[model samples]
Target: MKRFVVCKTCGARVSGLLDSPVALDFITKAEQELLSGGEYGNGDNGNVYISTSDKHHLSYHQDQNRLIGCCGPSPYGLPNLVCICKSEIGREVTDCCTAHYVMLYKERIAIREDNTGLLEKVVSLPVAEDLKSQYEILINFGEIEIVLNALKM
Candidate 1:
């Protein structure tokens, strides 16, 4: 079953759930380096990244003369990925290296079941008091560590 990645604040569909093998490989290597005492980002505040190649649902900003990637660092050196509502959702991290992925912060996005199953079955499920919370349940797509670490940050 497919899942949808949405903005937790406004319920805007950011993108569909998809796996990026290149990101997995990059994250694995980063984790190994961290385990070995190698430093990444600020001391003890290593930036956690979620890689995504999909940017069609997102908008980018320009700082000075350069166009900022969906999740790239802003002119202020902060993650610049913001929803239409101006909420900082994530950052484009592909510029950090040759990798083609965006580093999305988990806390900024909500994962919800696509509900593409039978309509009758979906409707029969108990209604959630807080629909947002219900959709916040993390679903593992072979990248649990990325979501976990993003939460830690």
Candidate 2:
């Protein structure tokens, strides 16, 4: 059931964990009301807030000016993260003064399910050298039951 947050503009994977929702402490009463029945980022304006630790495939803004800060990159001003395609993706706030987190613009990203589990399930198999071939066979035939049974053996 793992979900990934991908950049809508370039389809680059940004994070593997989409379970963490924006915490209540950070949102005001008005913002809370706006987010009542739905999760964060469902509307046009709010953002999907996640731990700074969960981010991946994202880099700081190329502009050094945007990254200037005392302990880490400044949390103020503009979005600091960019996709591999170099399109602005989100804001990363990790300076010593603030709580470390990332705010992805809801409109700029989409969620996708991770359904490929063959390699992960077979990773611990004793036959390491043959894993690639076995994986290829499973993918070609679209069968994971063979590997699951092999694990039980």
Candidate 3:
């Protein structure tokens, strides 16, 4: 039941979900506050943050306007990350005045499920009713296949 963050437009893997999501509250705090003893995920935005080390298959936004930052891209503005297809994906907050992290927008990215590492199931959040059923069927089919293979032994 491992989930991965991926680009919605191109279906490229972004990052493995952090052991614990860096909460939106931590991202909003002043740099000093975060360095002291900041609590994470106490705010309402409910945004998920990831470390740059976990990132892959993503690049900085090509537009200069979206890249503005004292030390890094401003998190308050539009998404600063993009897939290779050049679709807006997420925001990277590394401003000198704030805690540094990457916030992938729920709308621009999707949660992809890694089940058994045999079959990949890409189910977007807020999944449609029909899609949900289809996903279930897929899972069931995979289980059936595993059982059938075991029976062959």
Candidate 1 vs candidate 2: which has greater TM-score? Answer: 2
Question: In order, how many clashes per candidate?
Answer: 3, 0, 0
Go through the candidates in order and give each one's C-alpha lDDT. Answer: 0.44, 0.61, 0.59
Model 3 alpha-carbon miss at residue 95, Å: 0.7
Candidate 1: minimum summed lDDT over ten consecutive residues — where? Answer: 34-43
**What is the per-residue lDDT of model 2 for residues 1-153, given as tens digits with 9 covering 90 to 100?**
445577888776676444324444443332123222223333235666555666767888888777767766655877788988888888876566555566788788887654664443443346764674465356436676775676664
Better of 1 and 3 by TM-score: 3
lDDT by residue (tens digit), candidate 1, 1-153 = 444457778766565343322213444443122111111121122333333434425665444223344443322345556776667776654433334344455667765554443222322346662432233333223343443354452
TM-scores for every candidate against the unseen true structure = 0.47, 0.60, 0.60
Residue-level error in angstroms, candidate 1, position 58: 1.5
Candidate ranking under lDDT, highest first, comes to 2, 3, 1
Off by over 4 Å in 2: 20-22, 27-44, 115-153
Query: Against the hidden true structure, what lDDT does model 1 obtain?
Result: 0.44
Q: RMSD in Å for candidate 2, one decimal? A: 7.6
